[model samples]
Target: MQFENTLEFAQRLDKQDTLNSYRDHFLFPKVNEKQVIYFTGNSLGLQPKNAKKYVDEVMQDWEELAVEGHFYADKPWWDYHERLANPLSKIIGAKPSEITVMNTLTVNLHLLMVSFYRPKGKRYKIICEEKAFPSDQYMLQSQVRFHGYDPNDAIVEIKKRDGEHNFRIEDILDTITEVGEECALILIGGVNYYTGQVFDMKTITKAGHDIGAFVGWDLAHAAGNIKLELHDWDVDFASWCSYKYMNSGPGNASGCFIHERFHNQTEIPRFEGWWGTSRETRFLMKPQFEPMPNADAWQLSNAPILALAPYLASLELFDEVGMDALIKKRNLIVAYLEYILKEIDAQVESTFEIITPSNPKERGTQLSVFLHGEGKKLFEFLMKNGVITDWREPNVIRLAPAPFYCSFEDMFRFGQILKQGILEKNSELSS
Candidate 1:
């Protein structure tokens, strides 16, 4: 389908969008007394109008029931997080028994490592992509150091080929084969935060396992933005934050998936607490640990009801629209966004380098573009003009048109704003 950079064309696309009306469910911030065109949902999602209602319900329960709210409240705070497992499993493609909502993303990664990242003599190296998210970098470094190994030796980073922006599948597979028996674990971000590249998880997981290594993913950007099959992929474990595409509030609870084979393993090493024990034996307060028969076995404490509230609310939207619908819109909108960027690039003196893969299967809702001949001033111009987006170092801006709330009109408006900023800069330089 052809796309045009006109308001009428954008409006017609919007009119035909089935998910278009759902935009009203979110509350967008205003700039210049108008709702801004939001492109930072990959950073922090806009607040759902219903998020307050979810939080308020918990607040009201706490006010009236006091400590008893854990058992007597409408949803029952003790088991409130259990509500999220089913819907979240659908989004991440796992059984309800394989999913659990718990601590933040990095925290869950640390806990999961206790079971997956074991190193021994002659088999201790861990494989990961180069320039992973800073938090994951820190986590890997610390974990390796804690296990009494030098990070420089224990961490094997798969570097991108010269003049390439994304990792080639063959390079990754060859790296795994080269690492061979010494590779203890392979953990990569499912969707690269910098380039928006979606790695081939199924093939990569198989490659890791064939080399006698455990495989997992940090789904911070992939969880709600793209389709996944963690169980089918035979991923040993995975974790994701809810605040981004999931539309939960800031620093909200994270969701995790642990393959069913790992469940109820008495010999498996993990950091355990009372909350991870079977519900029947939890309140018994026995000295010996009795683990749950599912992913909840990793829980360190009782659920944070308040954080889970907003997340549960967001999953309602996911359950209603489904990931299939979101992905369908995502493909078309991202394609249109790419078209608009190329069109605008041709008109302006500046060059736009889209580092993200052009293949729809290899990207999510984000387009990380390098605006050559443009500087932070262009980003500032955009921000002041109400285009909410993310800026990386060296003149790259990440635009994520979240399908649930972002519209084609937003894309059209952003192109206009971008062209205006470029032209204005050119005029000022000539003067």
Candidate 2:
């Protein structure tokens, strides 16, 4: 598909977009009076209009039923989180029983690791990328130290080659083989937050399993953004937050996937609670912890109804428009964004570099632009000009044209504003 760097071309594309109706479903922040160009959905997605109604429904249940809401209210609170499992299963490509909506991403990471990261004797090292998300880094470090191993020795970080923006898949495979004997677990982001590189989870999972190591993913950015088949890929465990691409809201509940192979195996250890016990036996007040035969056995506590309402609202959209539809729009729009950004890079005196993988298969909607000369200042310029993007450390602007809400015209306008900001900065330098 050819792309032209013109407003008319963008408008034409928008007119033809099948998912264009979804844009009206979300609430965007305003700049002056008009809507801002929101490219920060990779950080916090815009609220769905139905979110309020969902929350109110939950609130109404609480108000009317009080404690009876657990069993007899509309949408029983006892089974609230389960409502998300089926819809979420569709998005992540897993068996409904293999998925559960629960705590936040990092908390679920810790919980999943409790069962998966069983380091015995010499097979104690954890393999991960050098630049994992800070939460993952901290969790890995603490987990390694908790098992009485030096973090530097027990944690193997796969590094990219010098001056490269992302890690090579071959290098990742080689590292897995090299550390196969000593490695206990392999954990990595499905889509890297900074570079937006999507790892080949299927190949990585096979490589890790071949080496007698468990493989897990922190799918904070990948869960809803990319097409995932965690069960078919044989991903041992994975977790993701709902606020970002899932468009739940700020600090909403997250989802977890534990392969069915791990289910019904009480031999595997987990930090258990009453909620994890079988629903039939839970009311009996049995001191013994007989875990559920599914992924819900990992739940430490009952559902947080208020926190989950928005997530359920959002997942309904995901279930309505499957990943195939979202990815179709995602690739074309992202390509258009790439084309326009490259055009800006070519035309501007002060330039930016897109650090994300060029191949759509290796990325999602995110495009990380590493600004050279006066780029940090340009971030502020973009914000003041009503472009809602994210600024990373040093000088990278992470922009995600989220498929649900962002339009082709938004990409064109963003490019024009970014060029304007760069040109103005260059002029300031000259004067």
Candidate 3:
């Protein structure tokens, strides 16, 4: 599809968009008294207008029903988390019984490690990608240290080739094989946060299982942004934050996928809590902990109704539109964005290096661009001009044109803003 850098071209794409009307469902922030062109959905998603209604329902339940709201409310507070399972299952390609809403992402990872990361003798090392998200890095380091091993020895990082931004699948498989006997766990981010590169999870999971290692994924960025088949991929376990592309509120509840094969395995150690017990026996005050037959066995406490409310609201949108539709729009919009970037680069003769994979299969909503010749100042200019985006250290700016709320017009407008920012920076220097 040939893309032209013109307003009419962008508007035509918008008109043809089936999900274009859904953009009105979100609440955008105003900058300079106008709605900002949001590009940071990879970090925090725009709030759904219905999110307020969901939260209000929960609040009213608590207000009027009191403690009895646990069983009497419209959604029933006690089993409210269960409502998310079916829709979420569709999004991540897992059975409803295999998925659960639980603690935050890193916390869930730590809790899941209690069951999956069993290290003994030589098979004690954990294999992960180099430069993982800092939270993951800290979690791995702390977990290994807790198990009485130096992190430098216990964590095996698969490094990218020098001068390359993305890790090769061959290098990853080779690392897993080389660390074969020693690798106890293989956990990697399904979509790399920094480079916006989507790892080959199914192949990587197979490689990890070929050896004697439990494999898992941190799907923080991949959860709603990419197509995932956690169940069919035979992933041992996985966790993700709901705030980013999932469009839940900030720091909301997380989603977990534990393959059904592990459901009734009582021998697998987990940090049991009040909610982990069977629901029928929960009110009985039984001393014995009888775990649920599903993924709810991992729940340590009661669900956070406020957080889950927004998440359920967001999931309704996902269910209505479906992932297939989202991905279709995502591919075209991202391609259009890339074209606009290249066209702007040619027009301005500015060096803007997009480090993300050009292959649509290897990326999601994000584009991490290295802003050469224009750095912090250009980022500031965009911010002032109502182009809300993300900035990493040094010069790379991350722009995630989320398909739900972001339009093709946003892409064209961003290009114009980017070009203006660069030219303005040059003018200041020349003056």
Candidate 4:
């Protein structure tokens, strides 16, 4: 796609977008009572207008039916989570039974690790990317400690070769080869939160399987931003928060996936609770844990219907638009953002670089911009101006133009703000 500089380019792209109507569906933030250019979907997605209505339905069910709402209310709180299964499955490309709506992202990550990360005597190590989200790093470390293994010895972190922002796939594969025998699992973010690099999940899964290891992913950044085929990729399991690109709101419940092959397998031990028991027999209060034969078997508690309703509403939108179409639109918008950023970089003397991969295939909707000097100042300036993006510690600003609502015009406007912020910072430094 040729890079063009004009509002017409963005307007034309918007005109052609099938999902353009989705912008009106969200409640964008306002600056001075005017809608700001929101590009921070990597942190929190704009709330869908239907979210309130969805929540209201659940609230009404609870109010009218009381405790009976569990089994008797409309959509039934008992099976409310199940209602989300098919739609969530569609977003991540999994069999319906292979996925389940459950706990938040980090908690689900811990749960998945418990079932999938069993390490035998020699194969006790787990491989992960360096600079993974703090929550994931903590989960892995705690899991290793829980298993009576030293994390420093049992967790192998793959870092970028001297001064690089992202890890190369070959380096990851080689690390697996070098440590594959001793590795019991590979838990990686599908897209790196800091660099916006979308790892090759298929290849990573294959490498881990070759080493007799279970492989899982944290799709918090990649879930709705990228096209995924977890089951087809032979991914053993995965988990993700819906609040990011899924637009489910802050602290929304997350979803998980387990390979269909594990559906009926009793060998994998899960931390079970009553909600995971078979729905028909659950009311009987049977002592034997008769888990549902799928990812639902991993559930440890009842679904939070209030937290989940918004996600259900969002998934319906995804089901209508489809992942392929969303990703196609994302590629164009992100490419436009990248083009504009490059122009800014070329025009300015400041040391700003886009750490995200130039190829759209290797990334999702985010661009991680690395500022050589005064990163925090530049970030603050952008935020104050209402170009809302997220600032990671040390030096990166992650901008994600989520396809569901973010526009090419938003990206262009944001680029202008970023350029202006950089100029201001340079002027301050010179003075």
Candidate 5:
């Protein structure tokens, strides 16, 4: 586990990496005809080489089969979503029957709230982390407004203590207790988008349940990045976008997981559509809506095959290697990245603080760096040098080395570029 900030050490690690072959599967961004080091998978994944092949198959089916493609094409449009269930289920730790691929992340969250966020008298407030992804904040505000309650009254945010970058687990549990019977739902990001902190979902779920509240997670940053056990954790419902760590391309189809207990609850409220009806009765076009016997019951429209093709392609890779292997490489790379950052800070006398948790169990592949004094200069320097990372407001750069395609050598090259950027800033200020 010893890490050295040297090209030889990084190259040696790359030589022994079992997942090194996966780098070739993706199309890395090129700058001036050279490949750029990409560290933005937590925002948008690189395109998989097989994604085109998968899209082509669907296009060919459309050209040849037309309307009949619904029945005759390979991986028929009628069941395209089903094709992803098994692999998707394994990735998120649920049964195929409990999982369904459909709309984007926020849309699914709204639909799920229709059923899981049923607010009875006094139990109408929702609890979540402060500074959740903007989409989540907007959704929560709108959902609360739709229910005829002011957001200030209906939304309880779990804020970090003064000057802390992440929320404390005890504080979260105590907040749940403080809310008590007023809490209708407890929803949070499985991984905080900005700080790269992974919340303790198992304990949080248990706390919510004990207080008679439904629990769910926005796994936009966690779903494929970290292994989850939604069913065993007794999570009532959850939704995630596949484009992040899943490497399913931008704006690809997302996934939903509903507890098996909700499958037979025909009385549950939902925004239903034809796609959610039973396959047997779908062709009948009957007036009565007979919802499917699984998570598909939440689907509001037909599958978007084109958008889903890339997801299937990526899931094939996940299925082949499994999460256990991916997570192992992810942890190793994260450690190496942390080591490199610390070494640069120690050697260069620069201010670079890692805001991401040091514990491997509390984070996935992301490391958020808080740069002081010459933050924007260093960021622009790295970008010009082709070291692509994500930047947030006020001076934090998020570098996420995706396990499927990023290599140990990438860490080495990134470290070198970062050091150069820091030195460049110093020279600029001195001049």
Candidate 6:
């Protein structure tokens, strides 16, 4: 799709968008009773219009059936989480047996670590990117200390080279090769949370497995935003929250995946609970823990039917639109945003630099912009004027134009707002 050099081009793209009607499916925030151009889906997606109905169904089940709802509601609360597996699996590119929707993201991360982070005598190290999200860093540190290992010695962080904005894939591979023998697991985000850079999961998984190490991904920023093939990539395990691009509400339940190879491996120890017990004997009140023999065995408690309903609604939409269509739309929209931003930068004196990669395959929906002089003030100005984007620490402002709901016109308007902010800064100094 060639974008013309006029605002009409963006309007035309919006008209031509196949998923344009999906915008009305979401409830965007309004200022003065008008919809705001929301670009913060990377942080909190706009709520779906049908979210209330989804929640109401579960509420009705609870009201009508009470305790009986677990066994025999319309959807059967006992197996509520299972109904999500097929659709969630399609979003993450995995089989039904390899995925399960359950606990929150950090909680699920800990559970997966308990089962995967088996640190043997000599090989007791973990490798992750240096600027990983704080929650992940804390979890990794606590896990290492819990096993009586010093995080300073046991954790290896791959950092960007000097004067570089992002880490090179080859450097990551080299780190794995150099420390492969000592590393027990490679747990990194599928997309770097701060930089908006997407890593090559297949290559990373292959490198880790070549050295007898487990590979997992924190897909918090990747799932539903990018096209993933976790099963094809042979990723050993992965976890992600649904609130972001999935458009589930904040603090929504998370999803986890375990490759089919581990389906029957009873030797691996997990922190088990009654909910993960075999379905056939769960009611027998048995003394021993007979796990459910799949990824569901990692589940810890009864499914939160209320929390899982929003995901069901969102995943159904994803199934209808499909990832291929979303990704194609995303590439064009993101490239348009990048092209306009570069044009503005060139017109000015190179005041803003895009930290995210220019290549569409290397990023999903977000573009992290680094302003030269005054980033925070500009961000605050945009927020007060109703252009919604996220500000990371120091100098980065992240804007994600979600393909499912955002329009090319939104990107065009964002460029105008950004240019106005920069020009305003110049005028204030001169005045």
Candidate 6 C-alpha lDDT tens digits along 1-431:
56654689999988989999999899888755666778899988888888888899899988998999888888898889998889888889999999988889999999999989999988999999987999999999999999999999999999899988988999999999999789999999999988899999999999999998999999999999998999999999999999999999999999999999988777787888888899999989899988887899999899998999888988888989999999989898889988888778876654788899888889999999998876588898888667888888889899899998898888887778777888898888889
lDDT of each candidate versus the true structure: 0.95, 0.92, 0.95, 0.88, 0.92, 0.90
Model 5 misplaced regions, further than 4 Å: none
**Is candidate 3 or 6 superior in TM-score?**
3
Q: Tell me the alpha-carbon RMSD of every candidate.
A: 0.6, 0.9, 0.7, 1.5, 0.8, 1.2
Task: Judging by TM-score, tell me the better candidate of 5 and 6.
Answer: 5
The residue pairs that clash in candidate 2, if any, are: none
Which candidate leads the pack in lDDT?
1
Model 3 TM-score is 0.99
Which runs in model 4 stand beyond 4 Å of their true positions? Answer: 426-431
Models 1 onward score TM values of 0.99, 0.99, 0.99, 0.96, 0.99, 0.98
- Steric clash count of candidate 5: 0
> 63-143 in candidate 4: lDDT tens per residue?
899999888987888888988889888888899999898989998898888888898899999999998889989999999
The TM-score that candidate 2 achieves is 0.99
* After superposition, candidate 6 runs with Cα above 4 Å error: none
Model 2 clash count equals: 0
**Which residue pairs clash in candidate 6?**
none
Predicted structure 6: clash tally: 0
Query: Whole-model lDDT, candidate 3?
Result: 0.95
How well does candidate 4 score on lDDT at residue 283?
86
lDDT of 2 by residue, 5-120 (tens): 99999999999999999999999999878799999989999999999999999889888989988999778989989889999898888999999988899999999999999999
Q: Give residue 189's error in model 4 in angstroms.
A: 0.9
